[model samples]
Target: MGGVSETHQMAPRPRRRRRPYRLAAALLVLLGLAGYYLVQNESTGGDGAPHCTVVAGGDAGGSYSMNLEQARYAATIAAVGTARKMPERAVTIAMATAMQESALRNLDHGDRDSLGLFQQRPSQGWGTPAQIMDPVYSAGIFYDRLKEDVPDYADLPLTVAAQKVQRSGFPDAYAKHEPDAALLAAAFTGRAPGALSCSGPLPQDTGDATRVKAELVKVFGSALAPKAGPPASRVAAQQAPADDSEVTLSVSGKDYQGPADQRRGWELANWTVAHAAELGVQRVSYGSKAWIAGKNKGRWIDKAPGKSGDGDPRNAGPDDVRIFVAPLNR
Candidate 1:
């Protein structure tokens, strides 16, 4: 045994060759992490950057997605059309025009003195700078012009109708946005219920009933807004405690837009969700569906029907919409 040991130089225990395995394992782990993050960012905007999507409703349906700000302006444009009782066709025309002109950014600058969503120039008498900058005001006037100046606009080709109002040098450009605009119009107009949603870094401000009602009235008009209850009610607003966090919008659906229907309720609900990032709306419930802010993809989940017991907003009527905003104290 001593003689064998003397002769044996244990051939430098052939270096285990473990490093290659270790490197392979490390690469696999890194690849796994990268895949996970990409998936998260695409689905939920995991960085908390706000995002919104509207899916067209049908068997051959498609979708369009955008950041939070553009979605808000789109909602306002559609609301202006609805408040005017203009058909969905008119809304599509206006949306396409805005997309071509401003990409819906509500730009304060454009060609020459042009400004606002439609890039209406002050020199053109669209309005004063201040009024034209207002999204609701700008959109309202656009629809007014379309209705007054373009007879039978709804039946015209979208590009033709939009070109007539916008008078853009790139007249054909509006037609390209028609697919995206039509999808948006259908969703925002309430013809495609639960078709719109947002994912977010929720706003930090507290929800204000007054602020919400004022926004609604601005878009839907004071005379036609659904009757309010409790904190937001015209009568109770003066006396109700300042802490009320939710507003009950009684949707008789009788006064605004076309004939009373469930779509009107969805219209209000979708608009609320589209602006939830700015308005501090935490939840919006209409009929049997509810949307929660900052949730993954901000999907509309089904809830039970009732008169305000569960976390779900009261579904006492078919058309009522309840908006639960972030509480000031929270």
Candidate 2:
């Protein structure tokens, strides 16, 4: 064959281009993933939806039944911090106090007609009966005091700070509820977002410790437990105690009967858990039944004879669902 001239030998035509469909498809997938994450973070819109549970008590027509609802609602609003802006430690302290004070209820009565979740006594001018009943308003007042008190009282014991504002009959009552409060704060503050959850009768927010534990497992996984048995060092517990206030929120009867109320309970629980360390909570428990070492399903249990319900004998009964907090040093 005769040798072709260099100019005559044309380069192979460039490969024909295909449509940009593949590139467009990849971009759409990326956008979809981003949106999903945003929703999960509850950043796409207002404070996002609350993740809460229900806690029933009494024969369904008693003080406990009524109080449970209040407690649940209190937990939800306390967790709010303007979307992701909430602090984990702050939420924890809120939970601890809620556990100790009113068992999370915004009650109308106390030692001297104390009102709202903190048991703000009308005698002491905490608030009027009507104002205390408003979850949002009540939570705001509590936070205001907390913000001021917590700054200087950061190193103080959980009970100590609580007592400064509460002036409770027993200053040490808040100490016990610290542990679980911390756990709930961690979950609610978005530090452990999606970590707090409920199971069993999801519809009923009974303060069952068993169900609380189950929710902990659902959120934090089995790794929440240490390789060894429960820790023995109080200081260690204080340093890094296992958060156990698994019952973030419980909408039993009066307080959180509606969906809005239930959502509010979840927010408070999450906030408390997220701020556990800051609030000085080490562990948390709720419902009529405390967490059964290793069980699920919270049953109605009476308070111990001497212990009293959450330390208040007047508050004790099979009907009441008490919230137990952990020690400061764990």
Candidate 3:
């Protein structure tokens, strides 16, 4: 006992165990890397916008795949174009309808002669087979009514507002499509409309901005120009068509269209013009009311109409827009 006390055993210097700091740090780094990879590959199954192909038979009376393909393209164009034209809310609703009506696929066949992306019935005054087949026109027509009926559509329920325009037999059908449409809208609008596309096969073909714009001109008219720098040549609209007009546009899709039909006509016209460069449009006409006669005669004007609301005489009807275009110089 006395010896032990004297020895005062240096208390087994508690086997000083080294801290595992480096190991811990390494593990944390590995976890962080794994998380990042998981998120990035979340949507694409590790292959973004994969080139998956499906057989969609024909525009109508074709394979289910073919029918769906049409709708997908229609949805893509509408979502992207509307995002460019109106607000996100409108795009959301439009996408929702396409999702339900055709699974975001343009089906030439629908209940009792209905056709096109919206399943619009030619017999009911939508348009002809060819016209309805044109996605841009169909979308434009849908937008016309949408802007008219949807007072504050951006905030309205997607299904509710869409039903107002579509008057579908089954109003509730649109509800089920909200999820998928949201996804497509997000991807097309560049807002992450959805975390991913449908689990099914991805469309092998998707049009580009240039292609879409060209189709826009084909379906609508040569009333739009691409968003390019100054035009290589421009012909004074006044000097051309007697009915030719002018319109001042803004980023908000606000503009002056003059009279009743004039407003609608011009709105569409201006939209075409705005999309001219993108659509490879060569010439266009904005109603005379839109022309300042002096101020930046050819330059775009945004302050004239639709700025103050219904009071502005130049403002077009909620559904009216009559505008057209020609080659820049011709």
Candidate 3: tens digits of C-alpha lDDT, residues 249-301: 22112232224234334333433433333333332323333311112212233
lDDT agreement with native, every candidate? 0.79, 0.45, 0.47
Error of 1 at 213 (Å): 0.7
Which structure among the candidates has the greatest lDDT? 1
Residue lDDT tens for model 2, 93-117: 6667877777776676777677767
User: Model 3: residues >4 Å from true position, as ranges?
Assistant: 1-75, 193-213, 216-330
State TM-scores per candidate.
0.79, 0.40, 0.43
- Each model's total of backbone clashes: 0, 50, 39
Worst 10 residues of 1 by lDDT: 230-239
Clash pairs (backbone) in predicted model 1? none
Per-residue lDDT of model 1, residues 90-122, tens digit only: 999999999989998989998999999999999
